[model samples]
Target chain A: MKTITNKKNILYSKKELGQIQLLLPVILVVTVFSLAPLLRGIYLGFTDYRLGDPISFNGIENYKQLFSDEYFWNSFKIGMVWTFVVTAIQVSLGLGLALLLNSKVRFTSFYTILILIPWATPPIIRGILWRQMYEPNTGAVNILLTNLGLISAPINWLSSFEFVIPAVIVAGVWGEISKAAIFLLAGLQTIPNDLYEASKIDGAGLWDQFRHITIPVLKPVLAAIISLTFMWNFNTFGIIWVLTQGGPGGLTRLPMLAAYEEGFKYGYIGYAAAIGNVMVIILSLMLFMYIRVQLRERTES
Target chain B: MKRNIYIVLILLVGTILFFLLTRKNNNHQNIPLRFVSLAWQEGTIATNKSIVNEWNAAHPDIQVEYIQGTWNSAHDYLITAFETGDVPDIFHYESSVIIDYAMRGYLTDLSPYISSEMKNDILDVAWATVTRPNGEVDGIPFLIESLVVLYNKSLFKKEGIIPPTIEYPWTWDDLQSAARKMTKDTNGDGVIDQYGAGLGLRNSANIIMNTSISFGGSFFKKEGNHFVVKVNDEEKKLLQTIVDMLYKDKSVSPASIGETGAGMIPGLFSGRYAMLVGIGSWGRQQLVENAPKEFQWGVMPPIKAKTQTYGASTQTLSIPKKSKRAKEAMMFIDFMLSSKNTARLALNDWMIPARISCLSMPEFKDKIGGWDITCSAVSTLSIGSWLGAPGYVEWKSRVANPVLQELFAGRMSIDDAARRIEHESNIVLSRYKKRGEVW
Candidate 1:
């Protein structure tokens, strides 16, 4: 077979040639557009490439700087905390809401639309609106709480180091819960109804049914949703930039924000590229695990 | 033979027609000049559109292409344009980045293009902003908004505290004492219903630097070839007072109030605070439109410690060096910053005219409220060359601000905060030091 394929004249069929022709555009696009820029970015990671300035190969200088930089490490810690907390909260809230909406309920459509309002709002707008609500004085949150006699003074939500991360997490959950719910709801609808009915008749309470029939049936979907939401929350930059600017002493400075500060504010393009390369490696590992699980689950099924 | 002759004839005719069309198109169309300006606010967007439209109508040979930009992404946007060689003919930028852009050889020197008379027309402080250390005039100042203390007159009267005035500006002692006295429990709820003052202490590096300057302190001293951090006793004293006001006195608005776009304006407008310490003339229009009609306000120079001082940002118009339409952009800049046009813009009462001659216009004097006091505050405007020092923004955001916030939060002593700022700033500034440069 190898000998036979080695001959150029072996392609004696027009149909095979037509299939190869049809795939050329996609191959060309990937090569020229996607792969080229990725390779160039990787090259930039090792250079001193300030924008509009002369660039030269620096031989790991950027990464060397990254290793010793206190701010970079702080940003990594903050990004991990932000991503983990936001993803956990969003997934839990999304699962709960998906189950609720999946049940018999009146005005299901109305509830769906209402829940989507936060998701429909742009991230920057959500950041601004939430920042306004978190205003120390004259904000809706403060005014409402004051009126309810919950506290004697308005809380400093965004500027207190202790409260800034939690406040941003609240905004993050508010903006992202609807997206998770919608995705999980779609997955939930795909599960067979007979499984739940069968479980109920077999002396299973609601909790038992959820633990056995619901969770087992929806495991793959849940995994996929969680992974996707994890990536989304991990890569979030606009909301934090708009709301806090990674401030109140850099409490909310995610890796992305730190990268922007290094590249744009400090004009350290090479250092920024090194940080981005690290993020890409982390995200790639996550995606690799997700893909492995997907393949394994498919083979098992 | 007949087919070949027809094909040759057709090709010849097509080539002739294409050349004719190209020539006609090139001769008839105007040169396109792209201009980018701030569009993050409705007022600015409207103003930019109006000015562009007026300019286009008047200059038939030069068509203006307007691009709206936001402050959050403007730096990256402009820099990307430069890297890609697609720079705009003209762009509006904050004064902070003018030195950086000029140093990078992005901005065209305007001194050759500008007349001495035109240069002399602008305020000295405003002109100093665009003039680089190498004496290159790289930008034209279009607007200047001087910082001042804005106070609610009604609250002061009710508290039996005298309002600050230009002639009798509040001293640091008077400011604190008055602020303490004005803190009140209006509703008998056992809680202070009103804050005495609101100074933006969160993420306000400019305000802090200006405050330190006012207290007779300098953040950096010029050595033979580099800047050395010199913020010592005076700066610590200045920060201690602010921290005391926030944590001990509790007479000031919460530091968190400064973290939002609403800023202290909302607090002052809602009567939650009697005074706003570091607001500019830009906030004057907001107060006029949003403050209750019964709520009267006054403007005074910033509080004096050993000296009366504040910082000013002169929004600038610059022509990119790579712009094909540099001459046209200069023309547009001149037209925009002309005395009549500056005065007209000042009539909107949102910005003060950068042109000294425009400031003398009766329209600026009569049409704008608190215009005189805002202009008078310009004399006390101390231009900090250190603000434009290389790597200063990073030092401000990463080093100075975080340490200062710790002091304000009572997590660190004033001495420690000052020492940390000075040490970190020196480390950052060392990277930018040259052999013979001085501030």
Candidate 2:
């Protein structure tokens, strides 16, 4: 009796074919809606395309101009600072809330539902709410601060160079914290009670157990959330646009805002696309590093 | 259950496809046109809707629908719409943007479509706004605003100051000193409760470019062929004046410096600003609802600096080149800008009509709500030098405006601003030279 010694299957089996057919609609949608535009945007980055004008190949001229552009560099630096600050604040605070909610407490379910309210709000709505609340004369923030004797004069939070980035970061974090919190909460739930119980019997303190058990187990979830938050915060446009329009001397001009202004406002379509392309490359590099690190860590463990 | 869901989804898809097919089959004959309007005022929106309704009722063959738009993102919206060829057939935009669109060749040169009577009706200066360098009329100029300094009459009276008139205009220095004198520290607080002047200097380029002629600053110059951004001394004067109001005089509120014309209303009503430097329409139209009962505000007559002139960036109507119904759209524009309709539209908008005949209407001559002041200042409406220059928008947003904002915010020195303005503006203007537009 001879066994069929095939190392690989030459054809998609009947079930595999069915699975692919089931995914056909999704593949079609992604190709048409997302992939097409993405490819078009990338192609446009290499051309000198102005609004309603004939497009011509210009090689890497747009990228060259971007390299020399002081405003572009400034916006890039601002975007980095914004992304870092927002992601850091959101993750730490979100983890803290998750931990508190996971603890045996009163109305934990009710509090979890209440925390999700901000996640449902649109970014532009949050921006408008924050802008109104930051109004110098009648804004709730200014009124409350003044009543509490925090400062003598009202601070123009959205306009001042010193405060604008921080203010927007606060607003950005407010609308996004629940997303991180929920993910971390789910990861926490998946953690085994036996591990904590064993740690307690071993006379391990809260910090020791968290550092050894929670850190090791929640590493993958943390990696995913951190990467996602970083990407989202970097590409943010709506809240900053509505709140500042990259104004007060462009102290808050993120790369996305700069791209928007260049493309829509100034009609420099190719240049804007070039900016977008550069952002994508930077983000992809960061993502690639994230995956590599994750793989290495998994191998080590 | 899953199979049932899939069948239901198929039915939904079929229904949608059926509806789309039916819509395409039956509506091929009467393709309706869309008119996007940036009329946000309650009265203006109502008037715009009724005008469209009246046209739709009259023209059974060529139907036009009104699409309400906001001024906040009008330029951004139009740029995308024009790019995607999804624009409304007739769009209400400013001549500044129309000039930009025309420079890009996005607009239909309505020269042949414009009627002779309509051509003769609109003033030459107003017509010149949307006219290209080659004399192609890209749009119909319909409404122009009169620049006025609206003052609190009660505050002026309390200060015992005489209101300046068009005949006896205030000198630049007089206006400055008056503003300084009016700034008061009431309620024994160290902080000034009432600012002397609060100017809506936001859209710094718009304010500076439009009013720079009044300060003898043309800002833009045509050198040989391409337009050059000139910021030596004349342009610096206007920006310095704004900066001085905020810093040197300390009479203008820092917050108000970044507000729009309409945004200055709350401060004006609350007496945070005793005087507001803005356009005429803000006082005439926007105040109808925001004003306190019997709130007496008077237009502080014109100010004379180097020349008592300001640029008139008229709100205009233009047809997109890609619009299939260009001829019908032109008809709608003509209907919208007729003598009677223009007058009604201008009255409702609280702006001066671009049509020459509409200026003589009895309503425009009314002394109430500063209509007399508004109508008289029409003579100072100079054709903006920045209108035809595509490079100007880029230069303004990138170089001139940010510097002016920083200067007004008291974050940058005047010398530093001047250096940056010239150095950066020259770079921008030189970059646009490659576009071959000015040439």
| B189 Cα displacement, candidate 2 (Å) | 2.4
Task: List TM-scores for all candidates, in order.
Answer: 0.87, 0.94
Score candidate 2 by TM-score against the native: 0.94
Native contacts present in each candidate (fraction): 0.55, 0.57
- Per-residue lDDT of model 1, residues B342-399, tens digit only: 7766656467788888777665655236777777666788677475566666677788
lDDT of each: 0.79, 0.83
Report how far residue A185 has shifted in candidate 2, in Å. Answer: 1.2
Report chain B TM per candidate. 0.88, 0.93
Evaluated at residue A114, the lDDT of candidate 2 is 89
Model 1: fraction of native contacts: 0.55
What TM-score does the predicted chain A of each candidate obtain versus native chain A?
A: 0.87, 0.93
| lDDT (Cα, tens digit) per residue for candidate 1, span A1-301 | 7778767657657776655655655675677689998888888899988765788998888888788788788998889898889999999999999999999899988999999999999999999999889977667988998999897777888888777888899999999899989988888899888988888788899999888777878787888888898899888998999988888778889999999888888777887888889888888897889879877986887
Query: Which residue pairs collide, candidate 2?
Result: none
lDDT by residue (B1-439, candidate 2, tens digit) is: 4465467558757876898788564335487888999988788899999998999899999888888888888888888888877677899988777877888878999999988999999988888888876778888989985678888888888898887887888877887888889887888778888788887765666777777888888878777777776676777777777778888788887776566677777788778878888555645576667788778887755678798888777889889998877888898888888899999899888888988899888888787777777878888779777767757767878887777777777788877887887788878887677767751
Candidate number of the best DockQ: 2
